[model samples]
Target chain A: MTDHAPKDIDTLIELLAKLPGLGPRSARRAVLHMIRKRSILLTPLADQMQRVAETARECLNCGNVGTADVCDICANEARGNGILCVVEDVADLWAMERAAVFKGRYHVLGGTLSALDAVGPEELRIPQLVDRVTSENVTEVILALNATIDGQTTAHYIADQLEGRVTLTSLAQGVPIGGELDYLDEGTITAALNARRQI
Target chain B: MTDHAPKDIDTLIELLAKLPGLGPRSARRAVLHMIRKRSILLTPLADQMQRVAETARECLNCGNVGTADVCDICANEARGNGILCVVEDVADLWAMERAAVFKGRYHVLGGTLSALDAVGPEELRIPQLVDRVTSENVTEVILALNATIDGQTTAHYIADQLEGRVTLTSLAQGVPIGGELDYLDEGTITAALNARRQI
Candidate 1:
């Protein structure tokens, strides 16, 4: 800052810069743009941010964020019929929801099992997930964790915990949609080939 | 959004998405990050934004944004002792101040001359700049606009208007600091060679 910059504007820039994918330069640009559009963007954005700060909370059962004590997904009985999608984070849960492919409820583990980080079954929402499976009468649980090593380890851990108790499945590994074979990695290509099926 | 997203959170995301260098995906991630860090970041940021929205205003003299009617650079009598740096926008003026090389005042033009956009001298702070040259005993004016076509055109227009009244200068065109010849374009290399001095 020039020291001539108002303290409030400078502070806003610093906090905004802390956000993911934004650095100091982009944050300054964002602040300038906000100052220029005070009514349409800045004031309303401030109001909304304050409102979210006051009300946003993690779902009691699934760890998903929402305004209520229980997230909409967990509260809706229609969504909790049978299948339960298990994910590594709320971000993954939102992504699955965005695709609109999954009709069942979700369980966010918060994080994966990591020995270095001292994260274990008790650290995540695993116990809550198990309770939900039995208490909510879930018939099938899909391990939709990421393809990372830690993610797979967590998936296996959950599978062991729920084995024989209910039907369990994992998302199929294959070439992604719109992916070109020429640009595909060897592991993905191999997986796609190994899991090839009749159309 | 899955419609499960709280209205305030979604509204905040939408407003944030309108900012430069952010899109829908990044905005979603930023909102999630903000919600996670509510006390330290989200609440404080909201407060600061509201403060800026209520207090920040453009300095009537130079078009520089500050919390007062006249910006610090314009109000300080010590900074008015001759040289004036003319910038295309408030961002450029702030950049100049951050460098701390200039010990004079600044005049923000608001924007450069644009034919298609029908922007003329009156649309910017050009008239006020000319008035300051005479009223404030300015001896020199530095056109610190960007190296864009409109910027240069605006610089030349201002130079013609203030010719013979005060010394007019433009930033030198050449390789930028830390720039390498191997990575430089031909035009910059040519400009550097043309402006080469005996070392």
Candidate 2:
């Protein structure tokens, strides 16, 4: 920004630059766009951010982000079909919800177990997940974790803890709905071939 | 976002998506990052945006954005070196300031003369610029507009109006600093060749 730019605008750009994908250049562009569209973008975005700051909270039972102690998913009774989907992060939980295919409640693990970073089950919501499995009418546990090593390690640990208590399942690994075989890696091709089914 | 997402959080994501270079997916990622770093990013960013919304205004003298009627460069007596650098927009003016090469104050044209868009001298700050050139101790005018058709047309218009009144110049054309000759376009190479000088 110019040295003559207002201190407030400079600070806004600085803060916006700290976001996930934005750096100084893109942040400046975004700020310029906002200032040009102040009524439509700047003021409304500020008001909305303030509202989220005041109201956003973590769900007490599932660790999902919402406004109340328990998230709407965790509070609803019809969605609980004795199946609890375990995810690695709130973003993943939200991604699952967007599909609108799953009718079961969710349990957010916050993160996967990582020995290099010194993260463990205690650091995640693994204990809360185990407690929910026992308290809720959960008959099956679906581990929808990523295919990363740490995600698989965490899944194996959870399975060991509830080996015989509930039925354990995981998301099927194969070619995605719109995926092409030419673009897929060997591991995916092998999985898809091994899991071949008849129509 | 999930159907169970808090209404305020959802609204925040929607508003953030309206920003330039950001879409729904990036907005969700940004919201997640802000919520994770609430104290360091979300609250402070919201507060700073509110402040900018209340204080930011276009300078009456030059159309630059600041917290006052007159921009800092326009008000600074030391910068009045009898040279006014004319630019097409506030962002262009800011880009010039960042280079720190020019010492004179600036005149933001707000926009270039565009017949297709129905923009003319009246729509821009052309009248104000003409008044400044006469009222101020301006001995020269630098047309630092972009190398586009609209920009050239605007420069020609300004030059015709202010001919013989002041020594007028435009930015030099050539390969950019650190630009490779192999990657430069033929037009740039031609311009550089035509304007070549002895070392």
Q: How many residue pairs clash in each candidate?
A: 0, 0
Worst 10 residues of 2 chain A by lDDT: A1-10
Error of 1 at B136 (Å): 0.9
lDDT per residue, candidate 2, B1-199, as tens digits? 3434678888888888888888888888899889878888999999988888888898888888898899888889999999999998877887888888899989888888988899999888888889999899799999999999999999999999899899999999998999999999999999999999999
lDDT, model 2, position B166: 95
Error of 1 at B77 (Å): 1.5
Q: Which ten residues in a row have the lowest lDDT in candidate 1 chain B?
A: B1-10
List model 2 lDDT by residue over A44-134, tens digit each: 9888888888888889999899988899998899987899999988889889988989999998888889889899888888888888888
Alpha-carbon runs more than 4 Å astray in model 1: A1-4, B1-4
Q: Which candidate is the best by lDDT?
A: 1
Tell me candidate 1's TM-score on chain B.
0.96
TM-score (all chains, Cα) for each model: 0.97, 0.94
Over B1-199, each residue of candidate 1 has an lDDT whose tens digit, in order, gives 4434777787888888999999988998898899889999999989989999999999998889999999878888889879999998877887888888899889999889998999999998799899999999999999998988899899999999999999999888999999989999998899899999898
- Candidate 1 lands at a TM-score of 0.97
